[model samples]
Target: MELLKAQNIEKKFVNHLALDDVNVSIPENSIYGLLGPNGAGKTTLIRIINRITAPDKGEILLKGRPLQPEDVNIIGYLPEERGLYKKMKVGEQALYLARLKGLSKRDALKRLKYWFGKFEMEAWWDKKVEELSKGMAQKVQFVTTILHEPELLIFDEPFSGFDPINANMLKQEIIDLKKKGATIIFSTHNMASVEELCDHITLINQSRNILEGHIDDIRKKYKSNIYEISFNGEVEKLEKSLNQYYEIIDKTKVDGHSAVRIKLLHQTNENELLSLIIPAVEIISFKELIPSMNDIFIKVVNEYKN
Candidate 1:
């Protein structure tokens, strides 16, 4: 079931159309990636969903019903621009924000203690936010964002300041949240994170949704029928075995074995290429090369511009 749906969403600001007839469906208990370059209207759409601003056209639905003001209670949003009272003690600010989300003091403290200990943040609770490093402050805000345990969690550029270790920790926590039934909308420029965490995605560009679908399906659709082979054979003999159907794009040595990347042309299949090459050289390993999300992102955006 879809946890959230924005249909025919359109937003305009005085002279600019920020979002144009955009649509997105976020499934329950899944991580949905919101992607696009800067000025692509992704943030505008996220604000609309958060009810920070109203759409000029179209309606948003939460669990098949028209979204309600009360629905904000069930949604947790961590904006791209971090906001925390710099002079306030970490624990104090966290408790305050949790209360704003309707958690009682007793409940808030219990959860805060648990998360602080988990993130090894207990030592910093008494310290002021301004004293913390960017990454540390971000970790504090992250804890507060999910403190209320909302059903829908929206993270915009959630990994902006973290080192590799903290970033990976955040990634694991996000995966755990999904396992425990939280639906997440992750927005970021990191295509690698999208590949690792997103089950589905919506790519917005030029004030429009240019792409939307499962990650694997999108990759498969954009594939060029290229394959990489590794074998301990003479490169000259391997070159002699292929016909016009195969175009060798790259050749290199991997761990003392010769490797070559071949692209199929004119309806050629890997089996046929393997058949021709198997007899010519010893076949050690063969695998198709799929386009990365970063490649697709650039390809689609550029194609749209042209």
Candidate 2:
């Protein structure tokens, strides 16, 4: 089931079209990546989704129905720009935010304590927000973002301030959230994180959605029929065997094993490749090379610019 769907979402500023007929569907219990280059309208679309701004010409649907003002209570958002009051005590501010989300004081305190403990932040309870490090403060905001147990959570650059240890800790928690059925819309410039965590994604470019699909499917769609073959044989024989069917991209020896990367110049199956090369070299390993998200991002954005 789709927890949220924004169809034909359009937004504009005096002289700028921030979003143009953008459409996104976020499935229940899945992490959706809201991706694009800077100024490509990712945050504009995010603002629309969070009701921070109304679309100029589109509607948002939540849980298969028209989105309502009250739906904000059920949707948690942690913007890239953090807004915690520096002078407020960490635990006090957390409880305040939880109550604003409509939690009772008793319930808010209970949940806040639990999360503080889970994050090993109980010692910082009485400390002012300004007293903690940026990463520690982000941890508090993270706790508040999820304290309500919102059904849909939107996080923009949530990993910004953390070290690898805390970042990985947060990543695992996000995966855990999915397992427990919370739909998430994650926006970031980190393509590697998207490759690791996103089940589906929408790539926006020039105020438009240029790519949208399951992560695996999108990667396959952009595949270039490249493969890396590891073998032990004379490089000269391997080169002769490639002929016109292959384009050797890079050849290097890995820990004494000969590895060669080749791009298929013509449409050919793995069997055909093996048949052509088996007689020339001893095959130790073979694997197709799928273009990484980083490569795909550059390709798509550059093409759009051109």
Candidate 3:
């Protein structure tokens, strides 16, 4: 089921269009990546979804109904620009935010305590936000965002300040949230995080959606039919045999072994390629090379400019 959807969404600021005919459907209990370079309208779309701003020419649906201002209570948004009162104690600010989300004082305290313990942040509760490091403050903000168990969570650059260990910890928390029926819309430039955490993604460029789909499907769609082969063979003989059937993209030798990458031109199975090369080389491994999200991001963005 789709937890949230923005259909043909368009947003404008004065004379400039910030989002143009954008349509994205976020599935229930899945992490959807909202991606693009700076100025691509990623933040604009997120704001529209959060109802911080209205779309110029489109509609948004939450849980199969038209979205409303009241729906904000059900969403937990951690914006790219962090906001916390620097002079306020971390615990105090957390409790205040939780209450604004409609949690009672007692329940808020319980949830805060649990999250503080979970994140190993008990010692910092009484400390002022101004005293905390960027990463520590981020942890406090994260706890408040998820304390309400919101049905929809929007995280814009959620991993910005953390070290690898804490980032991994947050990643696991996000996965856990998905398992527990929370749908998340994550916006980040980190393609590595997208590959690791996102199930579906929408890529925007110059305020237009250029690509959208399941990660694996998109990867497959953009595949160049490239393969890497490793084997031990007389270099010249192996090259000659492979040249007969495949376009050799690269060939390198290391540690008494040779590796070659080939892009198949004609419809030929790996077995067929193997059959031709077996007598000439000892095959060690053969694997297809799929383009990574980083590659896809650059490719799509470049195409948009052209």
What is the number of backbone collisions in each predicted candidate, taken in the order shown?
A: 0, 0, 0
Off by over 4 Å in 3: 243-245
Output the better candidate (1/3) by lDDT: 1
71-131: candidate 2 lDDT, tens digit per residue:
8888889999997999999989999999988899999999988988899999999999999
State the lDDT of candidate 3 residue by residue for 1-306, as single tens digits.
899989999988987889999989999888999999999899999999989989989999998899988888899999999989999999999999999998999999999999999899999989999999999999999999999999999999999989999999999999999999899999999999999999999999998898999999999999988889899877688777765558888889878899989888887877788788889988899999999999999999998889
Better of 1 and 3 by TM-score: 3
Looking at model 2, which ten-residue stretch has the lowest summed lDDT?
265-274
lDDT of 1 by residue, 15-119 (tens): 899999999999999899999999999999999999999999999999999999988888999999998999999999999999988899999999999999999
Q: In model 3, what is the error at residue 290, expressed in angstroms?
A: 0.5
Ranking by lDDT: 1, 3, 2
TM-scores, all candidates, are 0.95, 0.96, 0.96
CA lDDT of 29 in candidate 3?
Answer: 87
Largest lDDT belongs to which candidate?
Answer: 1
Q: What is the lDDT of residue 278 in candidate 1?
A: 89
- Clash pairs, model 2 backbone: none
Clash count, candidate 2: 0
Which parts of model 1 have CA positions greater than 4 angstroms off? none
lDDT of 3 at 164: 95
